[model samples]
Target: MGVLLTSCSAPSPTPAPRPKVAVTTQIKQLLPATVSNKTAWSEDIYQAFTHQKLETSVSNLCSVIAIAGQESNFNADAPVAGLPHIAWQEIDRRAAALHIPAFVVRTALSVTSPTGKSYAERLDHVRSERELSDIYDDLINTVPLGQQLLGRFNPIHTGGPMQVSIAFAEQHAENYPYKKGNSIRKEVLSQRGGVYFGALHLLGYPANYTVPLYRFADYNAGWYASRNAAFQAAVAYLSGVPLVLDGDLINYQDDKPSQTELAIRSIGFTLQLSQQNIHQQLMLGQSIAFEQSPLWKQVFAAADKKRGQRWPHERLPGITLQSPKISRNLTTAWFAQRVNQRYQNCLLQSRRE
Candidate 1:
C-alpha cells in the first residue's frame, strides 16, 4: 500500500511529442525519379490525407500514389489521345438521336465562339478533358443553336489526373478542402482537387478486405462491390442460382428486382426472410453496414453448412469495364491487379530507401 501510494504520488512526467516530419519527404522517397514536379504532387497528396484525416501510413500513401500513377502519369490534365474525334463522334451521335440533321449541327458549331474560334474548330484541336469542358460550357451558355443541339449535356463523365467520376466528386464535394471554382467538375480537373477527391473515393469507405486488391477492385467497380460479389457467390452456392458476380445487388434504375436479389428471394424460406425483408437488407448493400446485416450472416451461414466449409467473404468482382475511351477488352480485375502491382512497387521503392 505504501509503495503504491508512493508510485501514484510520483507520477512520471510525460515525454514531449516527437516533431512531425513533412509528408512530402516521405512521398518523395516513394516516387520514381521520372515524376515531374515532385514537390507539387507530394503537397497535394499530403493535403488529401490531412484534409480527409486518412492515415498517411506508407501503405495508404503508396496506394494513392499508385492509383495516380496508373490513372495519369502525374499530369493534372492528361491529354486523351483522340479526344477531339471522340467528342465530335459523340456530338454527332447525340444529334442523330435527337433527330437533328448533321449539317444543321455542323453549321451551328461553325459560328465564332467567345474564344474567337469556331466551336467545331475548338473541338478539332481539343486534346485534354479540361479544355473540352470549358468549350462545352461556352457552347451551352453563349450559342442559341448549341443549346438546341447539345442542351445542358456535357458527355464528359470524368476528368483530371485520377480521372475521378465527376458525379462522384460532386456528391462528395461538401468536404473538399479547396474552395476553388463554382463547379466540382472544374475542381476535379485540377491537381489538388483530383488527388483530394481521388483519395476520398479510394480510402473513405470501410471494408473487411484482408488484402488491398479487393479494395482496388472496389475502387474500379464501385464502393462495396467486392463484398457484394462475395454475397452473390454465397447466394449462388445456397440456391443453385447462377449469378453474374458483378456485385450489383439491386437495379437502382429499374423497378424490377435484380438477379442477385431474386436469387436471395428464391431461398428466402430457408433464410426465414420474405422478399421485402430480403430487399430491405439489400438496400444496405452499398454500405459497410451490409456486412453486419442479418441477410449477410444468414446467407453465409447456410452456404458454409451446405458446403461444410466457410466461404471467403472477400472476392474480386467479375465485371467487364465498358467505356467509350476503352478500345480493347479490359475487366475490373485487370485494373485492380495493375494498380496493385504499382502499389506494391511503391512500397518496395520506399523500403529500398
Candidate 2:
C-alpha cells in the first residue's frame, strides 16, 4: 500500500483465421429444416466437400444454403401451379411433332403398369415434372408403344426447388453414393442425405469470380457464362459490336436459334471462328470442355491486354428479373446480387454467434 503497484495486463488472444472455420461449419449448419431436411442437407454438404475437395466448413455451406433456401425453400417436392397444363401442352406438342395419335397415347397410358395401376390415372393428376417423369418412366417400361411413341417424353428440368439441373446430376452421377434405379424424385426428397447432397451439386460447385452473382448466373445459365459473357462483352466493346451482357451462353427457350450464336455469327468473320465451330462450341457449353478451348483462352488474353490489368473474367449484369412470372428484359445478375446481399447479412449473424 505504501508503494504503487504496477498493473500487469494479460496479453490479447489472437483471433483464429475465419475462413478456416466459418467457411465450412457455419455454412453446413445454415441449411435448416425438419429433422429429415437437416440430415439431407448435411449429407449433401459432406459429399460435395469430399468430392470437390472443398473445405468442410460452415461458411461454404451457408453460402449454398442461402441460395438454395431462396430458390426452393429446400422443398424437393415443391409444386407449381399450371405445371400440369404446361406438361400436357408439352406432351401434345411432342406427340404432334412425332405424329402420334392422342388416342394411342391415351391407350398406351391406359394399360396397367407393373404396379397394377393405370398410367392414365397418374398422368391425369400429374401436376409437376417429377410426377410427369414417373408416368413417362412407366409408359416406357410397361407400355410397348411407349418406347417408340413417347420415349423422349422425359421432360428433364433444370430449375425450381433445389435449383437442380438434370444435366448437372447426370454429369456428376458418379459422385452420388446411392444405388442405381433410384428415381430423381426419391433422390431429391432424401432429407437426411440424398436431397442435401443434390443441393450441394446445385449450389456448392466452384467458380472463380469476385461476387456471388456470377455463380447465380452459372446456376441459371451455365457454369462459364459469367466468364464467357465478360469475354463477349470485351469482344463487343473492342470490336464496336453491339452485345447484351446478360450472361446467357445459349438460349434454350425459343424454337429459334440462340441469340449468343447470332452474335457470334455477326462477328464471326472478324473473330476468325467459323459458324460451325461456334455452333459446336455452343453445344459444349453444358460441359467443362468449352472453358478449355482456344476461343476462351484467346478472349481472356485479349480482354487482359486491353484492360492493362487482370479484370474479372466475368461479371453479373445490372438488369431486372424476367422470370416466367415477370416479363421484360430481366437479368439473373440482379437476382443473384440481391440474394448475395442477404447472404452477407446472414454471414455476419453467424460470425457474431
Candidate 3:
C-alpha cells in the first residue's frame, strides 16, 4: 500500500557506478617507465599480474620489480657468469655422492639428447639457466642414469626472471594458465610463467610485517621467516640463551624441536604452556596464525619485560645463505636490505613519474 502512494527512491542512483580501476592498464603504464624493455616487459608482467590475480598496488608491483631487478636484472633468460663450470661441478658432485664413476657419468652425458646434441655438449655451451634446465630435462627423460643420479631432484632449484623456486612453481601450479609442456621447470624459465609463479610465491602468502623490508627478507629466507626470527629473539631474551634467530622452529628433517624451540620450552613454566603446546604452536610457523598464538604473545611479553622495552616484532632472519651459486658470505639480512633498497628506488621512480 505504501509503494503505491510513495515515490520510489530511484534505486539509490546506482551508487554512481564507482569508477572501475584499470589495473592492467596501470601496470602497463608503470612498467614501461621503470623497465628497459618497456613494451615487452610491460605486456608480460601485466599478463602475469592479471593471471595470478595479484593486487596491482604500487607496493606489490614495486616489490616484484625490485626482486626481478636484483635476481636477473629483468632478463628472463639471464646468463650465469660461469654456468658451464657450475653445471659440471654439480654433475661431478652428484656423481661423487652416488659413488658413480666419472667415466660412466661422462659416458651417460655423451648420449645424444632430444635436441640432437650430447648433454655434455649442451653443458659445455650452457650460458643461461634455461639452457641448463633444458639439458637436465632431456637427460631425466631419456637417460636411466639421470633418474638414479638426480633422483627426481633437479639441481637447478631456482630459475626464471624472478629466480623463483622450480619446486614452488610445481607445487602451486593448480591454476597455471599455460600449457603443460615438458614440466613446470620449463614453464618457470619462460617470461610469463616465471613472473606469474614468482610473483605468486613472493606476494602470495599473508604476512603482518610492519615494513616491506620483512617481506623482502621472507621472500629470500622463507615464508614467515621474519616473524619467526622475531620469536627467536624473544626466546633468546627471556631465556638469556643465545639463539641464531634463524626462522626455523623445528628440525624440518625430524619431529624434534630445534634449538630455538628448546630455548622457548625452557621458559614454558613461565609461559604457562606445556612442551606439546609450544610444539603445536611452533608447527604453525609457516603460517600467519603463529603470530596470534599464546606462545608468540607470552614470549614477547616476557622478553620485553626483561629488556625494559619492546622489541620490534619483525627482523631479518639470521640465516646464512648456503648455496653453490653464492660465492660470498650473504645473510638473509643482506638480501632483504638489498631488495628493500631496490624496492624503495622503484617506489621513488613510480612517485616521480
User: How well does candidate 3 score on lDDT at residue 85?
Assistant: 91
TM-score of 1: 0.93
TM-score of candidate 2 against the unseen true structure? 0.69
Q: Which regions in candidate 1 have their CA more than 4 angstroms from the true location?
A: 1-20
Q: For candidate 2, write residues 1-353 as lDDT tens digits.
A: 01011112432332333443444455444545332446545555555555544444344555566666666666655565666566666667777888989987777667777666777676667665566667776776766676776664455455445556665666666656656456544454343233444445544443555555566566555555676677667667555667777666666786465666776677677567887787777676545466677566665666677779764566665345533323456567766675577567657766766
TM-score of each predicted structure versus truth: 0.93, 0.69, 0.89
C-alpha root-mean-square deviation, candidate 3: 7.9
Q: Candidate 1 — worst ten consecutive residues by lDDT sum?
A: 1-10
Error of 3 at 227 (Å): 1.0
Q: In model 3, what lDDT does residue 80 have?
A: 89
How many clashes show up in model 1?
0
How many residue pairs clash in each candidate at the backbone level?
0, 19, 0
lDDT (CA) per prediction: 0.85, 0.59, 0.80
Instruction: Rank candidates, TM-score, best first.
Output: 1, 3, 2
Q: Whose lDDT is greatest here?
A: 1
